[model samples]
Target chain A: MTLGLLVEEAGLFSTVQDLGRQGFQSLGVPPSGALDPVALRLANLVVGNPPGCAGLEMCRLGATLRVTVPSLRVALAGAPPTGDLPVLRSLTLREGEVLRIGRVAGGAAYLAVEGGFDLKPVLGSLSTYARALIGGFEGRRLEPGDVLPLLRHTASSRRERALPHPLPAERDRPLRVVLGPQADHFTEEAFDALLGEGFTVTAEADRIGLRLSGPRLAHAGPPEIASDGNATGAVQVPGSGQPIVLLPDRHTVGGYPKIATVITADLARLGQSLPGTVLRFEAVAPEQARIALRRQEAEIAALAARLHET
Target chain B: MCAQPAAPPALLHDPPRLLLLGDAALTVEFAAAWSPEAAARVRRLAARVAVLAAAEEGIREYVPTLRSVTIHVDPSRLSLRRLQAMLRDLPEGAEATAGEATEWCLPVRYGGEQGPDLPEIASTLGMAEDEVAELHTAGHYEAAAVGGYPGFAYLTGVDGRLALPRRASPRLSVPEGSVAVANGFTGVYPATAPGGWHLLGRTPVPLFAPDRPGRPALVMPGDTVRFRAISPEEFEGLWSAFRDGRADPVTACRAP
Candidate 1:
């Protein structure tokens, strides 16, 4: 049985994403995936789908999807809905039903279906990289008339469930980071300025990166480095001295000096921060960062196990 | 009668430095300056690491740049310290054998609407437009790095006389297949997007094809590339054939 949804009003910007395309960065391809992996996983879990299944990632302004089949199972995760619509819970929509997701409280939101989207994977991934105009639904944002095909779900997969707790939202907190391979490029004052509070996310922020504006970081040497491989969450300080936090859709390599990299555990929080949000940074040791990531993974595993038991 | 001249003491002027990029990635840098010696070391190390990664279970991916290699790993499966130790212990001076390099000849249409900046670039370099194209096509370049955009390659080997800084103001959108140069490196725009490099020509060959399985990029790091000038009519013919699967943009050359 085939399931589908027709786009009625595609909000700000929404696209289908998975865990990102891997093993391709060596060829200059960016891993364009959901900004918040935890949210995407949670949404999929609630809908009885695998954690890495493709789902819809909507930006601040939400979208409206019309169910075309007799019934469909879906769940929302990440941002809280502004209206009274239930989120972080699995719900079934009948044929001819309309599901409206209002403006999100955070930077983005994820909507997952029980059987996931039935789109062919491009380059081994269903994630969309709009910059290169490849992957996803037509390799671009969702349009009003686009019809997204959904894989048919088994009867056992269509049960209703709600998250034990509300999914965490992007909060006003210090984003923890690890001083980087080029930390020595910046002066002591610059380091202090970066760690201190005051940087505000600029409007230019997108899936590619979040540009921060504040004190200009002073460079001990030239700000340019030989072009090198870049990682997600790398806080790159270019010649202008402003810092740009690389994201999932960031270029495979860059030439600017990266003073620090935001720890993996905090990337979701960073992903949820909207434009104009004031943020600060705290440096941690590489060992500590590893421990934090392990802890996060353990927590997610425990959550999944508990849900299964329930 | 001759003992291979003591294999000219392996170029050790620049030692590789290993640095932690983050908790999950490590970068092995060979040298700050771009040179044949540095490029060789990078390729050698990358090859060694690829073998090591195949034997190990933790390495997720490895990307080789101009003079360095970045290795990504799963922090949960492997410790950063352990990976670093393994990299440090890799036997050095494993030169990349000559048999590994592949040569490709890319057909380009120089000047006209396809390359609007050709005249400006030629005038700036104090050379005629045809001379600029000839100089560009004459050199043999190595794909030092890939990334800036998907399938975008950074090729080294442009003559020093033709080297020029990037345009002060970048173009909002450069058409795909446009051959451009900047800061001693020549590259082709894999897709239409904003770029700061000076355009000298256009190629009918598609640099990137996500639809292709296995190797999506036509040009990969470490491959050798040469440009052959073609007329606009020839470009159209080749491009149509490529699109229709009647021709290949690249043809294999005899092993050098």
Candidate 2:
């Protein structure tokens, strides 16, 4: 079948999400989307769903979803369930049987189907802001006993296919970043210290931003600058001398000086990492990062194509 | 596309400086600090950009922060280059809306246990506690911005005479509805959040609510608010009425 099943038990933090609400940043709203884009695309492809269709984003400890109707294609991708578990895991759920995701292998997972999940749009977005309590399912985290209705789909074609295979979980990949436009705001010593040293993800991390614990990266210039726009991977060195890496739900702007920003290609991996994940940053040229991003996109597209063929 | 475009660069520097944020986002910033003029200008620009992005569906989401805007896009369909191009042709700025804007009359119970820092703030600003309370409630303040924790309305027009710095070390948690001021801005913490601001009093009003209609924020940008000091009995009665949903915020503030 096309549309999979409704979620009977939504794990840690689960909600329907797409690429997030974009143009509204000017409204003081952060664009919330799937944490792992690569996995999200793959899941959509595996289920024969449109690549842009909204999918379920599951955070640490996935939920137990029960497949209703008949059989359906589904794929799960995110950080490997702890211990280098494969990113993509395949499991079947009977009409009444519950599929449970134990503890989080990674912080997030993507549940995709042959047909996209049907959800009403809020401000033209299916993504949830939990804080604003808008978008997604009533704009809040999926709780136990929440009955979600699925977007109906057609029967599957006459074809047999092997379940999706998991990708190698790079739980320990070095975070690749590009020097920020404000890199000059930090001292050469602080900049060097940032790249040369390592940081551990603190427990105080969330979709808003990742707080890191390591050598404080002090601002070499004025501690305060006019508030400027920043993105998810912006490495903002706040007044505490500690760097806070902004994330999807980060504020629209900040006054802290940023030393560098993690290249966009690596943000998903960073977002999926659990607390205490040791991270190191390796600078990449902007051109190189762009090329790498294109390649990554192509790979995701290919993976989706493979699933459709089956 | 690699070469920088030649133009006057509008009000900002050359090419309207853009920084690649991560794999999926980019930030177009104006300057370093938060100036009211810059904040206003940025807000206007952000509103226009948001409208354009929504109309085109080329971008995902864009949020307006204090001084800049963050646009979240689907890298697959819209690349940084394309977004940059879209930014170049953006409609410039947001037109200031007319109408005096709705004014909110917030009722608060001042002094004693409710406001621990009231005396300290009064001393710091060299004004009597009653005088401080009088000055605070006398004028209407324009909401300058709404950031730094959800529902935290940063208001303008604090009695400049009562301005004081925030505590060196903030308390772990100030109860929700605590009215506080620091660094030339006065606000009521919508929720229980750690803050170094000077406490003035407590308002039982819900500043931030998720279930309410119309964006879920009590006081949004561009609203004017005036504080009214009330008795503890009034505070308790209003708190009960609000919690029970029997009273509307507008009605509560309007009542004597």
lDDT of 1 by residue, B173-224 (tens): 9999999998899989988989999999999888888986555788888888
Residue-by-residue lDDT tens digits, candidate 1, A1-310: 3358899989898999998998888999988899988899989988888899999999898889999877788889988779877777788888789999979888889999878888999998999998777788989999998888877633243358877764344376688888987887899999999988579999999999999999999889999988888999899999899999999999888899899988878888888878999989999988898888888888777776656322
Predicted structure with the largest lDDT when compared to the true one: 1
All models, DockQ values? 0.72, 0.29
TM-score of 1: 0.93
lDDT of residue B21 for candidate 2: 67
Residue A138 CA displacement from its true place in model 2, Å:
7.5
TM-score of each: 0.93, 0.78
Clashing pairs in 1: none
